[model samples]
Each structure stands twice: as structure tokens, then as C-alpha cells.
Target: MRQLIIRAMATGTVATLALGACSSGSSDGSAKGRTPYIGVILPDTTSSARWETQDHPALEAAFKAKGVKYDIQNAQGDKAQFQAIADHMLKEGVNVLMIVDLDAASGIAVLTKAKQEGVATIDYDRLTLGGHADYYVSFDNVDVGELQGQGLVQCLQGQTKPIVAEVNGSPTDNNATLFAQGYDSVLGQLYNNGTFVKGPNQSTDNWDNATAGKNFTKMLAQTPNIGGVLVANDGMAQAVIAVLKQHHLNGKVPVTGQDATVPGLQSVLDGDQCMTVFKDSVKEAQAGADLAVNLAKGQTASAANAMVADTVTGKLVQSVELTPEAIVKSNVQDVIAAGAVTKAEVCTAQFAAACAANGIK
Candidate 1:
């Protein structure tokens, strides 16, 4: 079955075509093959800002260096729109399909349909299970959750017996479960030890900020003396932080987040939020694009030493799992240096003094 998939992918009649043998000799670190046209399907722009601000540009730049043409489409938070975009790209004859898989069910449906037509799929940043996705590329998601939990613990170290609320990401997302496992692994130990009290834990839907805001408000109402919050990402963290601000508890209670978004970084610098996790998106985007080009050319992700264990599928799938770094006020510059966000964006007018104090200039 794998051989048949590879052979069909090599024909490149559906999406893009990989041009050569699977080798490490390509200048851009891709398999030795002709440049292949690539298609990228991102989930809603609202779910996470990183999709457009970071991943899109990084993927485009990486593909350009590898001599590949790329087409991109954003679903804009609509499942029907996501499916339409995938169908359109398939019709356009892209050799490979790389998607962020906002709604795994909808994304898998598209991927499964594409696979039947001899087009390969790469799950980008988010995994697409229950469907035959050709490859996966992103940070170790469980590690991301563990980082959030551990960071919150460290920030709450000197406090008295504290109450913690967990504002996790979309419930439909399998990664959300992985994140909770990581957080629970650490926090559960703390809870068992009686050092921390867990309270008001719930996962958001579609990672929507509005949903996160309402849930956060309810969680706060339920746990009046909450000491910290383990928010899954920057988006949900911002919503939670806004509610904290209303109660004058913004900087008082420590919060953990991921993606190191602009508001999250500013909150960290302003002492409103505690920290965030910064995934090396450039490396991830390049890895995904390289895999897409490789698969399009009939090469294997194994050629790049990228193999991943998919507990969801009970198989070792083709993938590259990158590491994530914790970003606090102390190391916000590291995220800037990583090009996750520019100094200009992070050090705006309101943040000028904070930037100068931190030597960000």
C-alpha cells in the first residue's frame, strides 16, 4: 500500500510532482528532485495569529529557496470554506497538500478524499488522524503542555497553597488532549502532594477567543482566589488576562501561555502574564514544505531522519517533532532573535520604555 501511494504520488497528476530521487544532496536540504508545486491550507486566521504572521511567510520563503511554487488559502474559521479551499487546490493540480487542520474531522475528510485521487497530505503544526495523511510536522505538542504546566508551577512557587485553573484549547483538537496530559502529569503530582489545588478546568471550542473569554470568566467566578491559570496558547491567555484585568488581578495571578503572540509577549513584559512557549516555526515550516516536496517527488520523510510516533493512529508516521522554548520577560528577546516576532511589532509605542529597559533596541 505504501509503495502504491509513493508510485501514485510520483506521477504528480493531482497536485505537484517531486522531480528526483530521495537524497540529502538538494541545495535546500530537500530530496534530490525537480521543484514541485505545493499547496497550503491554513485554518481560521482568528484561531491563532501565528498561521498568517509566521507560518505562512516562513513556508513561502523556504519553498522559494527550494525552487518550489506554493499556493496558500485560509479557511477563515469556516469548515465549508476549508473544504472548498482543499477542493479548489486539488482541482488546481497541486502535487502535495499541507494543511493546519483547524477542524480535524473536516480536514481528515478533505485529506482522505485527496488521497483517493493520488494526492499526498502533510498535517502542518497540527496532526490529522483517522485519515491517511502522508506526513506530520510540528513541535512536540505534549511537551508544549508540560512547559505550560511547569512554568506556572515555577511562577507560583513562593505563594501559599494556590488554586489553578486550566484554560485549554479547542476540545475537538487531539493536541488539546496531549497538552492536558502534559499539564496533568505535572500539576496532578502537585495536586496529590497538596501543594496546589486544581479548579475550573475546561477546554475551549475551536480555540475561539470569545469562547475562551466566557469560559475564563466563569472559571474565575467559580474560583475567586485562583493563583494561576494554565492557558493552552497565547490567544486563550489574552482572553483570560482581559478578565483578570477587570478584577485588578492581571499581574497578580501568574498565567502560562504558548505561541508568544504580540499581546502575550507584551503581557509578559508588562507583568500582566507570566510566560509563553515559543515553537521554532521557521524550522517547522521548512520541514513540512520539504516533506511535501519530497512526497510529491515520490521520496520519503525517512530520508530526512523525520519519523514520529502517532499514538492516535498506533503507528510511527513520517514527521519531524521540534522542541519548544519557554518565553518569559527574561527571555522574550530570544523569541525576537528567533524571528518569531520582530522588535518593531513587539516594541511598539506603548512598549517603547519596556523595550528600552529590556535592551530590545
Candidate 2:
């Protein structure tokens, strides 16, 4: 069983502080002398634009502000490239290594190697099921799914026995399972009581948008009555919306999404998508940087006040879990106010009127 240990703390932002005097050893757990260095490995760019547009810059800013030596790289969805990047980082002698694993097997290999080398490791954004990471940093993902579920339920109000289809993220990603767990808790009751009909559900490979489009297309073909969709993120939501447009059901069938990207927010404003969950990547990145900095300095990561049980290992891992917010058409401006997206990005000429109507200047 998976467990979550939570304690009361501010969830908005994590402060980045400069490093103090270095410890004896290098950041890579090497002989005493070299400065501490941190390494980060991102999963892919094709899954979502946030990997490059949001998380990369936020993490760079946080690390640069603290004068921390770090190398950040993306695997571009290739397992070999992911392993190669880790090998390079380890060879370069980083004190702390962080990763958003593409898959558990590859992640486990890298984390195990990092541990064998005596370097500290962190699972960032996406937790590796059984990886030997010292800490984990991410938003409460189950809450994200619950928000998507509740948002879908609200959007589906007044529909008679609506059929809901799920276009989930990659099957290999642990976050996808947690997300399904969350939304299913709410939607399952409706399915059991006959309040809603469950439609075709499938997981896309590596959260590919094109695969999501194909999966959703097949679902629509089999069950033309799919009343709502629970898409994992904005990229997949866009694909699902495109298919809905072909059937002239874009705005008619509500869709739930996450990551509050510019296009996702626009879809919500345009009434094409019902709602999206906003997770401030800056906050998540800052928390990760704080943890990495502490680990590099051979000190305890104070931000890891929470605990998450690794189901594969049955071990409780220290974590820093943040909160996520649900964003609908009515409150799209909140994402802009939080600086996750700019008004100009979401309020283009096509959506200008919608933005104005929603109180966005």
C-alpha cells in the first residue's frame, strides 16, 4: 500500500538560499577538494512543453541564484539517452543527482549506480517506484487527479448517464498510476451507481499527444456518446479536443486536463475544455533546488518534511509535496496572477474577448 505523510507548511513557494562553506568531499562523494556540483536529468520534451518552457528555466534560475554548479539535460524520450546522460553526469562527478525518470527500470539503474558511487539522489516531479533516491519533490499528484475528477463531475452536471472516457498518461510512469487512483476514487462511485457510463479507457505511450489522439479517436468511434474526457495533461487534452472538433463536439463534451499550459488555459477560456489543474513549476523547481543544494553540502534537506511510501520497496521516502489548484474558465486569471502563465500567452487575439470577460486585463 502507498502512504502519504503530511505536515502543515506553506505550499506556495520555496525560498532559494546561497550555499555556505563547502564540505570536505566533492559533491560526487569524491576526495575532499572539489566544489559541489548537482546534476539533473529531465524525462522528455515530447510529453509536455513544460519540460523545456517551464521547469528548465525555473530550475536554472533557482540554481543560478544560489551559485550552485549544476548540469541539466533532457533525454528526449530515449531510454538509452537517459542512461547516457546519467553516466556522463556521474563521470563528471556531481555531488547530488536529480531525475524525472522516463521509466522505472532505467531510473532504478541510474539511482542504484548513483548510490553505489556514494552520491545523493532525488526523484524530482516524477518518483521512481523503487529507486534509491534520498528525497522526492513534487505536487500532491493524487490531489491533482481528484481535482480533475471533481472538475469533470462539475462539468458533467445535468447530463443523463453520461459516458466518460479516460485518456491517461504513459503506463510506465508511476505518476499516471497515482493520477488514475485519484480520479477513479470519485468516478468509480458514479459508475457503480449507474449515474455515469464508463467508456473506453487507455493509456498513451510516453504521454504522446498523437497516440492520445488516436486512442481518443478510437474511443469516440466505438462509443459516440462519450460525454466527457479525463485527459492527463494539456498536451493530450489538445489532441482530444482536436478529435472532438472533428465531430462538432468540442465544447459540448467536457474535458479535464492538467499542467495549465497556455493552450489548455485558452481551451478552458474558449469553452472547448472544461478545466485544468495548475501546478506552479517555479515552486516545485525551487523546492528541488533547495533539496539538491542541501544534499550537495552534506546537510539534511529541511524541505523534505513529508513522507511517501515507495510501494515497490515498502520503504517510506522523505518528500516535499506541494499543493495543486484547479483552474476553470471563471478563474483562469489566477494562473496568470500566480506567474505560471502570462496574460499575453493565454489571452491571444482569438481569446482576447474571453480573457476580458474573465476579468483578465
Candidate 3:
């Protein structure tokens, strides 16, 4: 379960994001006149559809603008295959390797090998450790969880004995740990203070929706009067809601989710989900592309090569973190403004009335 990112201060213009920080390399990225090639390795083809549906497209667009070529691969959740993917990309002479490792441990081994070959490696979305990965790029997950907790609390609206259930993401995902930490900071306080009682607290592997649905069904059975559910992401939240519908409990219980997926937004409109965290994947993908291009050209990522001790490995590594937004019915327009989703995507015929009532038009 990845935690939610808190709102970041507006940095003025969108392009100004370039000046923030870099994952690795020097300030200028690479040297001049190098048309470097990049390799993007994804963990799996599941969870949120944004990786293929949104991220790949946006990243390709960014790379095209820089006159760069990129090769993208998916490991399909296989450990050996992930390492093989990295080996193949490295053998292909890719200047930089960007990976969204589904299996962090195996990914770290891949990065270790890549580092031996002088290929700059980035731990994308999921952090890979082993003194090999050069940089990390992801949302402030802990803050994202905090936002979900806050949103759920507000949705409950003074329910003194609110009963809440938590459905976290994959246990293998360290991001889930960070997210749980963030959520605990908020809800843990209430739970400890006797204002809210936690019902079922479980972690879903692979962020699988069906798995989430089953776990939620069992959770609802354990606690028949669930007031709210804190699901790690929109994908899992949708599954939880589907189970809720089985008990005719949909829309009656406020649910929290991350990832402003199309279905997630529609669920929000339909009143099945209370809120979701919108991490501008395009922005994140563009940033990764920029860093990859720079690294491939033999330039530094940016002047900011600050070090942070890894919680998992205790090794210092370069990092660039982006803040995620809290998306609810009231501020769904912000997501549209960011071009994260199309108006038509959320304002379909079935959602026409809800969209209008929410002022999404």
C-alpha cells in the first residue's frame, strides 16, 4: 500500500517543475550532443491501468519532444523475468534504466547488476534498494495516506464511535508500509483516543481488485456496521465497493482511495467512493523522462543530489518526491484542469446528472 501524498505548494507555472530536483546525475543531466536511449521496466500489467493507458503515452510524448528513443517492457509480475528484462535492456546499450519494480527485492538485484554496468537506474513508483539504484521518484505516499484518513474522518462527520476498515495494498510493496504509516498517524490517533474503532485491518497482495473484493467481503462480515473503509488505491477501493454492493451497503459507507482512475472518479460521482488521491502520473512520467534523457546524454539529473538514508537499507540515495492531490466531488475540477482526465471521461450519460450536480461541467 502506497501512502497518499499531501498537497504541495504551487510552484507557479507547470514548467517550473523542472527546477525542483532530480532523481540522479548532475544538474545538467548529460553532456551535449548525445542522443541517449532510455529503457523503462514496469513491474506488472495490473493494479492501476495508468501505467499503460496514461504513463507510457505521456512518457513517450516527453521523450519524443527531446528527440530520444525509449524501449518499454513489462515483467508481468515474474521475478526472473524482471531481472531478465533489465539484463536485456542493459545489453541493448540503454544509457539509463527506469524501473517500476513490482518485486522490490528482485528489482534491487537487477539494479545491482545494472549499476555494475555503469547504467544509471531509477526506482520508479516502488523504491529498490541494495546500494545500486541511483535515484527514486514517487509521490509523498505517507502524506497521501494522511489525506485519505482526513477525508474519511470528515466524511464520517462527528461519528463518535465510527467503525472503520482498512484495506491496504500489497505487502510486498514498501510504499504500502509508508501509506499505512501515514494513515495510522491520523486514524491511529482516533482509534487510540476511543473516538473511532478499527474493524478489519488487512493488506492485499499485488493490489489485486478481486483479492481486495474478497477480503472486503470477509471484513464486512466480521464487522456488520462498517462506517468507512480506507482502501489503499482506487483499484482496491472499487473492489471493496463491489463487495459492499452485495450487502446493499454501497454509497452508505464512505470509502477512501488513491489513484484518480476513470472508474474511481465515476465511483465518486456515483457516491460509492468518498475521495481519491490524484497523483499527476503524466507529470511524474514526464519528470522521469526528463531525468532519463539527461542521464542518457551523460548529464546530471539536477544540482540537487541531496542524500537521504534509506529506511530499508540505511544507504544514502538520491530522491525526487512529488506531492499528490486529494480529489473529492467538490474539487474534481482540479483534476480536469490538470488534464489528468477528460470531462467526457467523467461526464458520460450515466454520470451526466451527477457531474452537473457536482459542478464538474
Candidate 4:
């Protein structure tokens, strides 16, 4: 498998990153009377809905408003496509490069090349291990996972020895690793104490929904008593819910998700899912855009919210880490108030009465 080969070949060492003479002149804004260019690459559309609906628009708006040159594209989960995009951008000599890496190894290759060309680079949303990026902007991924674990525990409080299945994000993603760390910290104790049954826990392939569906179905088959499901994001949770529905356990089982997406929110209202962790994409997108623009202008992203310690390289990278909030039926309206999702999208005819009761509008 590609995973095995990459893991075996991963160096985990900082690639030689000497930003040669390709530096963008001064830190004021324009470089040599020319507007700076920022190149951004998102991982894929299937990983999450926010990539297309939220992040892309916000990023474009930010750059357009600032009157900067930018080229943003989704790699569509293909490393070759990702490489081509990066090559094209580099050929145009972009001043700053930002990426949501599909895999750490491939991402490292891009960042390494950018560094060699003296282009400022940022690890956006997902951290690409062993890459020399100037900064990282994302939600506190470990905390995001912790919230999921805690939410599952709270959702099954009264149940005695309830079985819980975990549908985690792709193992190749570093953020997914942090999330697992957070949630497992909460779920592991209960499972060890026999307070809850830890059923099958599987990681989806590249955060794919179909893979999650198959994993969830397999878990349910092995442990039919599963009453709580901890899913990494809304997309995979939707797939799990469908399988649950087939088994007539949709409303009865508690499922956790993130991304406060329309479908995820509707599931909470319909009692088909427990809660979703709402990491506002606007905040992340705007923060990433701000950082990228600063870097493009030959400035550092030190104004970022925090300094992230890279476990692999043992170096601190400038970072902006936003908090992720847990969204349940009780406070799902808050997501609407924050404008992460429109009332029109979640308050459909089928969910009309529930939306009204929950003050979604």
C-alpha cells in the first residue's frame, strides 16, 4: 500500500530549506513596484464541505479585497494534481505558498521546493510533518478531538456500560492524529474502567465517506450493542447514520461529528446524531489569509495566535489556533447566530418544526 511505502520512506527531518535569492523585496507590501502573489492549495473537496463552501470564498474575498494576486485550487485528492498545481504556481514565482496537505510526504516535497525557491510557506489547516513552513493556521485539533470524546461521554451518561464505536479521520492526516489524542484521552479512561464498552475503532481512508460507511457497518456487525458512535466530521457521520438507520438504531444511538454542517445540524435536531464540533471556517480562512498576505508582503506570521511546537522537527512554528465549540440540540442555534450555516439550509420542510423549537431562525 502507498501508506506503508510512505511510512517506510518518510525522513521526518527538515529538508534543506535555504530561501535563495528569490525573496520578495521589502516588508511594506509591494515588491519592486509589483503586487505580491499568494498561491494556496486545498487538499480535496471530499474531505469536508467547508473546503468548497466556506474556506474558498472567504480566502478569495480576503485576497481580492486586499488587491493581491492569488491562485487557489483543490487538488481533488490526487498528489500528481497537487504537484502540478504547485509547479505551475512556483513557475509564476508566487511570493507566498499555503497548503492543506493531502499527505505529509507529498506536502513535504512541495514545501521543500518552495523553500529552495525562497517562497514563504504556511501549513494551512492540516500540518504537513517534516516540512519547513513559516507558519500554521488551524483549529486546536487535539482539543477538537477531546471535545468529541467528552461529548460522547456526556451523551451516554445515564446508560450503563454502553458500547461506543469510533470512526476516526484518515490516519495520514496529522490533525487527525491530534484529534485522536484528544478524544482518546477522554474515552480511554471510561473504556478501561469498564464504564463503557470500546467497540471497533477504525480510521477512514483519506476521510472518505464510503470508507467510513464500510467501517461503521463492520463495527456494528462485530458489536451490535454499540449505542454511541464517535465520528470525526459531519460527512463521515452522515454515512454512519445511514447504516444506523438501516438497522433501526438511528435515533436511538448517539453519534458525534464536527464541522457544524447543515446535515450535521439537522441530524442533531432529528436526534440521529449527538453533537458536532463547530470550528468556524470563516475564522480559520480569514486567519490563514491574513497570515499568507503578511508572508507575501515579506513579513512574518509572528502575529499569529500561538507558537506550535513541531513534534517531528522539535521547532516552534508561528501559528494561529482557534477554538472549536461543541454543538448540540441545546445550543445548535448558536451556529446560526454566528452565520456558519444559514437557517434556510437547515430549516427545511422536514426539519421545520424542530428548527422553530430550537430557535434556529
CA lDDT scores, all candidates in order: 0.79, 0.87, 0.78, 0.83
| CA shift of 116, model 1, Å | 0.8
lDDT of 3 by residue, 119-217 (tens): 888887777645457877777678888999988998888676989999999998877888888888899899998899988899998889899999888
Q: Please report, as a residue range, the 10-residue window in candidate 4 with the lowest summed lDDT.
A: 1-10
Inter-residue clash pairs, candidate 2: 27-95, 28-95
Best of the candidates, TM-score: 2
lDDT top scorer: 2
TM-score of each: 0.89, 0.93, 0.89, 0.90
- After the best TM-score superposition of candidate 1, give how far the Cα of residue 355 lies from its true spot, in angstroms: 1.9
In angstroms, how far off is 142's CA in candidate 2?
Answer: 0.8
User: How does residue 197 of candidate 1 score in lDDT?
Assistant: 91
lDDT for 206 in candidate 1 is 92
What count of clashes does model 1 give? 9
Q: For all candidates, what are the clash counts? A: 9, 2, 18, 0
Q: What is the C-alpha local distance difference test score of candidate 2?
A: 0.87
Q: Which candidate do you rate higher for lDDT, 2 or 4? A: 2
State the TM-score for model 3. Answer: 0.89
The TM-score obtained by model 1 is: 0.89
Comparing 1 with 2 on TM-score, the higher-scoring candidate is: 2
